[model samples]
Target: MRPLPPEALPVIVAARRTAIGTAGHAFKEVTADRLAAPVIQVVARDVACLGVPIDDVVLGNCMGPGGNLARVSALGAGLGEAVPGATVDRQCGSGLAAILMAGQAVASEEMELVIAGGAESASTAPLRAHRESPDTPYERAPFTPAGHPDPDMGAAAEALAAARGVERERQDDYAGASNAKAVAAREAGRFAAEIVEVGGRTEDQRPRLMRPASLSRLPAAFVPGGSVTAGNSSPVSDGAAVVALTSERLRAGAGLPGLRLRGGAVVGCDPALPGWGPVPAVRRLLGRTGVSMEQIAAVEIVEAFAAQTLAVTDALGLDPLGADRERVCADGGALALGHPWGATGAVVVTRLFTRLVRSGAPPGTLGLATAAVGGGLGVAALFEVV
Candidate 1:
């Protein structure tokens, strides 16, 4: 892992995402390809000032049709056939993985400008069946090897909470706070710059004006007597997000010197406690970048569940339910915005972009975006406002 030349490091110039739609509602009729196409187009148009041809379009997908979906998305976005595409699938980490790969390409000078992101349309996810019995539907493939402990995500979150001593009341309170922040951000038009309309929908479909009493009343979802509840977990979602990455010269040409890719790490954790994924990933990222948590001005860790969110913060030695909690997702997170599986990793990064770039954070400020994935994986990235 040799460091890339400073001049060749990837710098994001523009980024955008479609307002997240609930799985069975706003975007039910859309496919992953369709949801992603327009966002890529918007980034391309937005970054045209760079005057550099897009060398590739890399996208992450989870349950879309089995084909070169990045190619389909590139074509659909009108990037033309000449701009080849690649797709990556690390389940929930797919989107960030794609962006990581593209950023490395730019850092290595293999490309000048690249479009990278991810999309997911759970509503349009094809019904999967085992090959042994083609007609019998299955929910998903095994995330771990046979006979190894594998728990449903909700169950894992519950176990993590129990292990970490995070109580049900705390989880419910966190969920309520997340929703309130999201509602406030929406009302203040904080997301106006990064959200693009799709299918005539202009706003995210997941943010809720939840009352604490209401959140406390929601039933547990994973296990009997468990703290993990419907109110604290991410819902089925559909959305797409993208960012334009280029070298320093190209970013300067675009006149929008977006966040610079400082360092990134993808790490594996225990399959049984998959929610702990971000712990190792973020640690590795900090180690690589030589940046301390104290210097990170903003952070967004995907909140698939409040329990996992708490566990991650505690593992990072931050106050899971205190000031650090506010620093983690000041404008809300997946708990409030909805986690569109494959697209969530990119969504967090897009959130970081808005915070550092659109919100006028000063140069040298540090931002981090991270996500825990299905199958015991985590992805984390460090960005510097440059």
Candidate 2:
């Protein structure tokens, strides 16, 4: 592939996210649009000095109310009636998918600036039901049609663990380490700069110390006698993340440090083993970009389930226990911070922005953000500090 022109490149100039709140907790009364609007406002403000009108707002959502949430959130943020919005849905990968779409639009040179991210309020998600059975409620919409094997996310994780020989002990250990890292980062105020306060909440609701003993005692949450458990999986949560993306010309003219969008890939796999999606997705992205794992200074993968995370890392030849682990999720992940479905993908990107851009990594430092979707799909994007 030929290199893109400088003016056609997409660069992320600013990113912001609300403090994550566990479902039915601090943000229960807040709708998805409300959760998203504040973050959008803050990100827009962060880049206001550029003096460019936002051409559009794109957001990814899974279980929010049926309307175009991106437009609703943009209006709620007071971006004015001229700024249009579009919503994307790719289940768990919605957030990252939205960012990729925005990058594409910027690369095409049709827009000068755009606000893109994802938001999810699991606490306020409506009860869903099929039209044929309106009297009964379903937990979620099916990922695949009747002919394909589509297991619940938890069940799929369990199956993946069993198939890949991931043990309960390993999962618990990984979860404990992730929690500990998050707690330490929080105490160190590493997350303070990127977090936007909403409803007076300035901290994440789920990170805490996880002792091995307590994690060992928790019973299986999905399949009977299964290794997958709530202690090792992401909690339901509410949160929103948004980033300001602009063409390279704008970023250079403004003299702002940013992350240049390098490459992105989305791939599918067997619906029965959705957690394995990230492996192929990352491989595809790395291959396309010609960037090796050794070149990436930071990596953030959505830790939806400890077993699933371990499986992906193991397949990718990453060390989850060694010093190399620090390069991956240096602060923490969804396993410790709670997963807000659509928002989690954007959360990882925000984390990358913090670690690579905000922390002063040199220009050209590489970072990757990826997620495993619920229906056997994966999304991965590579970014370089600019």
Candidate 3:
């Protein structure tokens, strides 16, 4: 469903994202709850720079110990107590969900400077369940059967790849490209602007006495046969992203250069073909705004897997190889950095924001943000600087 009252000036004026810490290693000591505040506060604390009051904080998390995490994190983020906060969960799309909500609220003229973002310290992220009472639907009620449940994104990715006839090796190649580009971007300091340094040990933690390891030695998570190994897949990560949005009134009234959110979109595909959704969402956003794919200077498709990205790129009619690919994902991707589920979406949006700001292109450079959710779901949000 579309967000209400679809059209005013809820533009994302400023956005910032934290470095994608290697889960368990860099962020091993951080709790999911504790991670949110610092990552988001790194930027939201600068509300003064944006010149607007923070209307709300919408946060996302794939998993957390308790309810009210959004509110708790917001409080920790240094809000003035009066600023209300809420949490959202859309699995891998959770971060995007937060960003969209903020934009919707602002566009509806109900708010200004809505700070939306998400975080996850998958290293410290605990699954919700009582080990003593594993079968109880009672405890799982909030996050599972009711509020934020969906098919796992991995299973969906595998299914989508099969249904779409995506080859495993081809997917591996895509993963390789993601890593190569990401490494290059890091080398060039392309991501230096977005990834904030956290004073910590490694991003994830290794047991104290279990010191050094061989270069080729690393534990693997998930399946062993497939190309989606720990190296190829997104890293278990810890990070957050926040986009401080301001309305046109707030921008004009407060004398700020608030970038408009324009209209963002989400599209759905059959669960078995979930990877196909972005094609439609991208088309719709372009159709609605009278823009074309070629016009887009940068596009950020969540690298749920190399295959998912390759599939989406092919479906969008962009050359999966050659020059067109270069225009997309210029800042690297999840495969290279890390993917912290809920944080992944906002991470993409935050990166896109930086791309636009740094791009040599004029205002109105179209940017696309996309991700796949569980249960045959996908979302694509488009933005063009103005």
Q: What's model 3's lDDT at 104?
A: 80
Q: Model-by-model lDDT, in order?
A: 0.89, 0.93, 0.68
Clashes of 2: 0
CA shift at 217, candidate 2, in angstroms? 0.9
Tens-place lDDT per residue, model 3, 242-329, is 7777766665565544345656667665655565667777777777766677877778988877667777888787764567667777
For candidate 1, list the clashing residue pairs, or say none. Answer: none
Best-fitting candidate, measured by lDDT? 2
In model 1, the Cα lDDT at residue 50 comes to 82
User: Over 4 Å off in model 1, which ranges?
Assistant: none
TM-score to native of every candidate shown: 0.97, 0.98, 0.84
Residue 260 CA error for candidate 3 (Å)?
A: 2.4
Error of 3 at 379 (Å): 1.3
Clashing pairs in 2: none
By lDDT rank, best first, the candidates go: 2, 1, 3
